[model samples]
Structures are given as structure tokens and as C-alpha cells.
Target: MEQGQAPNGLSSCYRHPGVETGVRCTRCERPICPDCMVGASVGFQCPECVRNGSGTGHGPDAARPRNIAGGAIAGGDRQLVTKVLIGINLLVFLGGLFFSGLVDELVLIGLAFDPELFRVVGVADGEWYRLLTAVFLHQEVWHVGFNMIGLWVLGGPLEAALGRVRYLALYLLSGLAGSALTYAIVAPNQPSLGASGAVFGLMGATFVLFRRLRYDLRPVLGLIVLNVLITVVFREVIAWEAHLGGLVAGAVIAYGMVSGPRGKRPLLQWGACALVLAATVVMVVMRTTALV
Candidate 1:
């Protein structure tokens, strides 16, 4: 059989062409179907992710030192979109404050969503725009500040890698996914807004990009787990479900976009993302609405 061809059973592995290879890479150890094997620096690597040098050394951004507390804030290089995003979030938050006296609470409420938005008729009756615009809204100054920091830390490197459009798509997709998850699972009645959903997606994208570049993820994995733990246990007012959903979706989409040797077509990848979003909407309607 040719190297790329699949085997019935008694055939050479996918990693090596004619050596009758059976071993696979340690991390994503798919059976090397006679075309995918490589010698590892330490144990052995999948031809897909063979990195030079020993595995012990400075990580991607080790040149900069982070204070113990500061490290939790964000990671990786900064960029223009991340900065502008932070500025916009801050400005809107401040504007909301000044208008609080003059404006009725419903004005702000109009910008957010309640359980009733997904009416029993499978429609977004009133607060439907929250599906998109809520990403830019925040109830508190500190909420905006924290989410902006998250966006800056996570968004810069991703936007640089993906250019502008792909990054923005991932951000919007992530936020929608988070909101959908909340509606479907946690609390449909809850009015949630913040960039944390998009922000968590950045971490997800970062992990995907780093892992693809063959960077070791011991430190990154530890911090991600710790943050998830903190969000769930120690924190209140944080939509942990939204963050969790966005993180998972972001990582998956990022990997599909920029990870591996071959890049997925942008439109195809986005179509799949839209499909997932639609599915989430269906689920939320099922959860929050009843048949007439």
C-alpha cells in the first residue's frame, strides 16, 4: 500500500513508509500509517510536531519576568486591537455610569438578555441583540477592567497570528458560544455581559498555538487549570459557564485554523462554527422555553 493509504489490519504504521513502523508519537499517538514517524529529541515525536533541542529550556515568553500576582492577569505579547478593545470597554463602562441617573434601567436592560429572549416560539422575542452586543457590555467598572486585561493578554498574540478578520471571528464566535452555554445550561434568566468569554477563548487559542509550535505546556496547563478552579470555587458574579464554553470552543477553533501543517479553509471553518452556534441556540430554546 502507498504511505498515505489506510490499512485493514496487518499493515505497516502511518508514521513510517517501509520500515513496518508500529510506534506513534507520545502526545497524540495515532498509529503511524507508514508515513508519519520521526525520531524524537527525547523519546520520539510525531512527524507533525518534531522540535529541535532538548525539551528543557526557556518557554516562549521567558525573556520577560512576571510578578507572582501579575502573571495571573494575562500572558504573551501585546497588540493594537487588544489595546483598542480595552479602551472601548473602559469608555462604554464609564458612559454607562454617567447615564445611570438620566436613563432608565431598561435602557441598559435592553442591551442585555433575560431568559424570556428565547421565547417559547423558537424566537428571540426582545433582547435578542444580547446574543452579539452583550460582549461589549459590563455591569461594573472592575468587570470591564478585568475583562479588558484578559482581552489584552490573550487577544494580542492571537490577532497577530490570525491577522484581523480571523481573530475577530474567533472572538465573536467564542462570546456567542459562552452566552449560549449559559442559557442552555446554567441560568437563562441571568443577564450576563463581559469580555471574559472572548478572553477565555484567547487562552484556548494560545494553548492551541503553543502546542502546535511544539512548545511544552506544563506551565500553561497548570495555570489554566488553576484559573478554572478559581472561577468555579472562589469567585462569585463570574459567569463560569460562559468562560468555560468559550475556552473550549476557542481552543478547538484555533487548532483547526492555525495548528498542524495544513490550514483549514476559513469559510469552511467558520461554517462549522456557525453550525455549532445554531445548535447552541436550539438547546437554549429547549431549556428556557415551553411548547404552546
Candidate 2:
């Protein structure tokens, strides 16, 4: 029974309530209207199934899916991570300075990852805290300044994407991972300071997230490589191992938290992050126990 062409029993197939269509089923020559149309690269279907046989093309504006490649994270959730993190790191840096008798070297030396300190402590060790503390401690004035600037640049976007809690998690986790890696590879007597580890991790996370989202990677990868090279050549004071560790950790964490078209399940992502943290702790333990 033709729809509108009917009298009472049959409703308007072209504009029926339960008909469900969209435009036309380009294949069957049926009047599909709105609810019954299934969009294909070529044309709409009769909702029944994909028309592998259909040969026509949908017009230029065929309800295309969002590009979603470059949009901000967490759908741009409200956040204040950039401000708060900066403030906290700065405060810690100041405290490290004052507590160490306002001596620049003392502040840098005291709070930084001092493997010797970890080896000799009260009951267990005080060196373990250095890993967590070093991330928040900066040596030179310019050190904190540069770190803050970069932190502001990256934190705004990622915090918005991952929410404040998750963003902080990434920063800390990455820092921890970077420190752990350094301990695992390098001698502990080396006193490493600066938020370079956390910062590198942020870069890593951004790189992975953007690539997964399918944006231009040339910009991100190039920028990260360039900076890392600069750090190696010009900044011997830089803890290369900590930076490397943070980058790897942040990238791994970001992989799990990011969502939408190319994200992992939430539970899976959280679990992965937990595993990374645990692994970092284990590595730190090994470093402490080792003689070198």
C-alpha cells in the first residue's frame, strides 16, 4: 500500500510515524524520507541492511561524522590545573631554598634525587622521598621559569582533556616514572633536579594523544625531538634519564585516559596506569638495593 496515496488503513509511507526513513533508499527506488535511510559512502539504504550493490553517491553534505582530530581533550572540561600546579611547584621550590639555608646548591642538592641519602636513612630510607620531591624542586631561577611556562602551555589543554585529577596524575606519574628509569639506569649518587621529567612526560602524552586522534604529527614529534636534543647538547645539568622516563610514562598513561573514536576502555586505562606506577616503585627499590 502506497503511503500518503492510501485512504485510512495504510498511513503515509513517505511521512509515516513508524515508517522510519531518510530521503530514498537509492537502491530499491523506495521513498525513504528520513528514518529508514542508512548512510553509506555512496548512498542511503532501506535500514534493513548495507546495500553493497548500491552505486549512487550521497551528496556532498551526507551527515558526515565529526573530524574530531584536533578538538581539545575531555571535551574541554573546566579546570585550573595550570595555575595550581605552578603554584605548588613554586612553593616547594621556595621551601627547598629556605630550608637549605637559602643556598642555591643546597636547595638543589637537598631536594633532588640523592641516591646516597636513600641508601642511608633511619629505619628504612629517606632517599625514596627524593624521587617525589625532586619533581617539585627546581634549581635555578630560570629553571622554574622555563618549566612553568611549558607547564602552563601543556597543562591547560591536557587538564581540560583529562580533568584536573587525571592531569595531575599524569604529571606526577610521569615524574615518578622518569625518576625510576633514571635510578634503574644511572648511578644514584648523581643528584638530579628539575621538573624536566614531568615536562617531558607531558610532551609524550600530547604526542600520543594527538597521533591517536589522527592530527598532524610532524609538528608534535619535531618539537619534542628538537627540545630533547637541545637539552642534551646545551644542558649537561639536565637529568636525561628522568626526562626519558617521564616521557615514556606520560605517553603510556595518556593512551589509556583518552577517549572518543580511538580510546581504550576506562577501566583498562586506569589499570594500565596503576601497573606503570607499581613498576616504577619496583624499579626504585632495585636501585636502592644495588651497591652502585
Candidate 3:
């Protein structure tokens, strides 16, 4: 017999009796197969031990692991929200391909005439949903590809660190902040669309998260600098306003997520997000007032 294997089938996994395994759960000492292993801070734990939060030598009353934002550490796919967002963006892109009007209807516009609709239509005309819909809108293949890659790269870590709800809030609010700024500053008749705003927001949040964790800042800083340069150099084609808005909003929100008293973390974090949203609303209202 192999080393560490028990005799007479005693080494079989408790959860999978038919499968023989020499590995025992670190928490309960029960034989566990590779499929049943759940990584912990220490050795691998069984599913039951992880589920009950009893693997850390603490009693059953011990709290489950939590992320930086006080969210329960999720098992399995940590980037689920990021994946869903990408899927939605892709679906919208596909829909736009078949229905040409979909892009015009969803793209961000402060005020513009829709020839198809035979009337004036835009955010200023009370199409408030455009503020959000525009976030998922994309016309060019390159645009969507670039934004999706950034989302996959930067979004995964932030979602894992901040948890799903908080990360979703950050992403959406950042995108809205970008749209609001574009609406407020750009010509009312001008149009814009893309997920760059949200992607830039994630970049900003990644910077803050890395700083909080005391990781090497050079990589993130370099990326931010490079992107900012690209925005500046291509300011004529690029919506620098959206990028700027997202970056600032993301950093501010992430700071709120990582800083402040631990006792009041939830209140502080959500309060910061609320403040950003309120500010975006104000920008939209003020711009609409001016346009109309």
C-alpha cells in the first residue's frame, strides 16, 4: 500500500465512501477526497467544516470569513457579478447588431432628435433610463472588446474583495457618474456610449484596494498613468470626461470601502456610495434643466 493509506478501506473519503483518499480533513480529521477539499487559511477543510465555520480551532459560534467590505467570503466563483455584467454587455451588443435602432435608443445623449421617433428624445426629454442603459451600450467591436477585457481583469479582484453587492454598486455608480458628467459637459446634441467609464472606475478602485492592502503600487499606478495618457492624447476621439469622472468616482468610493472606523464600516461605505449617487442625480437634473 501507498504511504499514508489506511488498511482495509479505512482510508475512504467520508463524503465519498467509494473513492479512496489518504487525505483527511484538517478540521474534523475525516478522510476527504480531492473534490471535497475547501481551502482555508491553514490546511484543507471539509465542506461541513467550512460551512459551519468551525475549522479555525474556533467553536461553532465563530464568524464566517468576510471580505474587506464585511461581506461573507463567497465560495465557488468569486467573480460571478463580473461575468454577469460582461454577459449583459455582450448580449446588448448582439441585440444592437440585429436591431440598428437599439444603439440609438440606448446611447447616452443629453438632447437629440430621433428621426425614427419623429420627435426630440434624449435624457433631457426624461429618458432617465438612458443614463444606465448607455452603460451597457457599445457600437464598435474594439470598444466592447477592450472594455470587457478590462472588466474581466480589474473587476474580478475588486468583486472578490468588495463582495458582489458593493462591487456592483461601485461599478454602476461609476458608470452613472461618467454618463452624468458627459451629459453635463458635452454638447446636448452630442452622443456617447461604451463601458469605458465603468472600466476606468474599476481601475481606480483597484488602485485604492491595492494601496489599502499595502501591495506593490507601481503596477497599478503605471496602468493609470498609461490610460490617462491615452485619454489625453486621444481626447478628440475619446470621451475624456467620462474617463475622468469614473476614475475619480471609483477612487472616492473605494476609499470609503477601505477606510474609516471598522465598527461603522457598512454605514460609512454605503453612505459614501449614496453621496456619489446623489451627486450624479444633481448633475443630471442641473444639465437637464439647462438643456430644456
- Candidate with top lDDT is 3
Per-residue lDDT tens digits for candidate 1, residues 163-189, read 555677788888778776765655333
lDDT of each: 0.59, 0.64, 0.84
TM-score of structure candidate 1: 0.62
Which regions of candidate 2 fall more than 4 Å away from where they truly are?
1-77, 101-126, 259-264
- At residue 116, what lDDT does model 1 achieve? 40
Better of 1 and 2 by TM-score: 2
Model 2 earns a TM-score of 0.65
Q: Candidate 2 clash total?
A: 13
Give the C-alpha miss distance for residue 283 in model 3, angstroms: 0.6
Off by over 4 Å in 1: 1-78, 101-124, 260-264
**Candidate 1 clash figure, as a count:** 13
lDDT of each residue in 1-292, candidate 2, tens digit only: 5654334433334535555432444333455555656663223455443433322235542222211121222333244777878998899777866675322332222223334333332101444666676678776899899889888887776765565667788899998888778767764445566788899989998897666544468988887999789788976677788878888898888877654322335575677589779989898767656643
| Full candidate order by TM-score, most accurate first | 3, 2, 1
Whole-model alpha-carbon lDDT for candidate 2: 0.64
**Positional deviation of residue 48's Cα in model 3 after best superposition, in angstroms:** 19
